[model samples]
Target: MKEICIVEFPSNLGLKEPQPGKEPGVKKLPDWLWKHNLHKAISHNILRLDPPKYSNSKDVETQILNANSLVEYAREQAYLINNLLTQNKFPFILGGDCSILLGTAIALKQKGNYGLFYLDGHTDFMNISLSETGGVGGMAASIVTGNGHEKLTNILNLSPYIKEENLWCVGNREYDDEYENEIRNSSATYLSLHELRKQGISNSVKSFLQEVETKNLDGFWLHIDVDVLNDSIMPCVDSRTPDGLTYNEFNELTSYLFQGNKLSGLEITILDPDLDTTGEYTKNFVTNLTSTFNTFKNTIN
Candidate 1:
């Protein structure tokens, strides 16, 4: 079987404090997944990228929390992922938050034109002016698409890591009629949770893959935020919404995405271990996800 390297990226530098003095617990994600046997159930080749100190202070210049640190982290992350790709190993990244997308964006941009399959509960397409919180986590989609502050959008002098037309923002259920206009008006394809259900999960992924083929792009990246799961099943994330895809639908989506040849790598993000004190939700997540990944690997072999 071809290798799939599990990368542990535990950086919470992109989010604001959920309360007065507590940092986000998303940094504990890798450890939590490991305890649940995520590694044992899959490939044992794992690499970890230690994140900088978590800071809640927003940057004066960029107006986003830990913007400078995020930039530095992005470069480091890109270097690691680039190395993995060179070795023909598929990188399965475990993220600290949605902010990790910036690093993957940089790595993919360096290679060639790439598309993005963004699965999240919220658009996360907020810019500095539209964001109520100065969290870069909220602005990741905007930054990667070159719509935010230049420092983040232009990491390593490469701006717009992923082109707007190449992105497909899916599974978003945060139906803010006002704030959602930004993405709705953008060139990137938008498929809300309801629309996805109506279009059929398999059909949605097929359409995205068809676009990748139509563009004749090198490949694409997959970003899965756990909050994309229905809130009842996945409320551990810092940001939550009332609606999302179910585990069955999520499994089908993964199966179809994995069937495609153009998927370069994938990142799983925004699952908080702190909230699942009993570890029930994490175990359920690990079981469902690992099964999907293993099934895909078996098929490829």
Candidate 2:
């Protein structure tokens, strides 16, 4: 365990729609959560980052768009994460959206060779032609691995930031048919939601860990997309679904990462405050996550 640095992704990329618009999965935080007092309650040590407002300045409605300044902005975040980790701090990135992961992942790689475990319901493997919907965020994974647009992959001088062979998608429940064939043909490995529910998250992570240990990776980055949790319990996420991990199931999976010291940094995204009914969803999520990291806070201190 190490000190946790929390970063905030202030950019919305025009994803905050009133009713499932381009900001398809974006939600505004309740005024209460944004209150300074609310920030004090979380248990884990955190560092907050705010990217800036008005990120999607070129065209909010463009189907295939990449943030013009994402690369520079990502580098800023990378710089902070690197400096903190050098000081023995565990940096946790809280997203304006999952797009922030591109920056976070790149920053962690600068540290050394590390296995990338991208936990999301969608493969995020879609490109412009392949994406059912042409949202740039949908192409995040592809963008980072050099599979999508060059402008994005080349952002922050992070071309091929993550080698596809080393990237593993965990709990991909909303698989598009096109992505399925691609996954089968690709070098990346997958542990489906069905497989996880059957074998348990611990078992799945163990398998992945064994592979990493055998290969002698530098460390590992753990990225958690809120969509991985079932919408029944976590309704505030951008992409809500009926079938996903329960809160307890998610807690179990995450606790193991902390206990083993496998997770170096984290990024949580797609939480919009505008859509919340009572602010219960995001509050509960942050609460549970803090509890898991606090169990061994003494080790870090």
Candidate 3:
């Protein structure tokens, strides 16, 4: 398989802190993954970016904490991604939260129009008014599609970081009633967890890829928020939900996604090591991720 570049992003500004000492668990993700040797498993040419310091303060206008900071960080991330792409390197971005999607989307937009393969537990379509906690991570999808606050929607003078029809949301289980109309009206295609289970992951993914092919996209970004996995097996996520895919099911899905080499880049987000006191979950995550990369190597080469 081709070698790839790993980018480390360890910021937690997107989520709100519920308590004084209880910060978001994402800040430690990059180090945790490194300590466990994610770089060794994936590639040797790892480019570690210095993430902005964690900021929990909220924006006065948007009411989302670290709204401005996210934009700044995204711009920096865009520059780094642009450089990597220019050098013809595949970036495997290790993210702090789902909100990092903004930076990735912007970087892809800068190069050309690309599609998005979003795998997450929540739809992340909530607008500022609809988000109960005003977490930017919750509205990342909306922001990328030009449906959220103007400040976030228009980053680096790029409006609509990703086109709606080029986006495909998969493995989603959580839905907000208040924003149900907004989500339903979106042009982006969605394959809910129920639908995926009914169709089976392999078939469902094939269908999604076919749709993406019809769009004639430049390339597509694969975003995987670990919360999409079943809470029983993957319990380190901040937004823990029940009844997600098993390790075998997710591995099968990943193998299929990486086989064809249609992906421009990939991002893995939302694994909080703080919650996993025993470190068993991290070990499991490392094993599964390493196995998936190995599958990609065998299939793509």
Predicted candidate 1 versus true structure: per-residue lDDT over 129-192, tens digit per residue? 9887798888788889999879899988889899999989998898888778989999999999
Per-residue lDDT tens digits of candidate 3, residues 28-71? 88789888888788888877766666667778877887888888
Deviation in angstroms for 285 in model 2?
1.5
Instruction: By lDDT, rank the candidates, best first.
Output: 1, 3, 2
Give lDDT tens digits, candidate 2, residues 1-301: 4655565665555243434334443524423345423346542354556554533234343344345556556777778877877787776666666677777667766777677787887777666677544555566766667776666677656677777777777787875567666565667786778877887788887877777787787777777877888878777766666798888988888776655445576666676766665677777776787777677544543
lDDT of each candidate versus the true structure: 0.89, 0.66, 0.82
For candidate 3, the lDDT comes to: 0.82
Global CA lDDT computed for model 2:
0.66
Q: How would you order the candidates by TM-score, starting with the best?
A: 1, 3, 2
Model 1 TM-score, 2 decimals: 0.98
TM-score of 2: 0.85
In model 1, how large is the Cα lDDT of residue 251? Answer: 92
Error of 1 at 208 (Å): 0.6
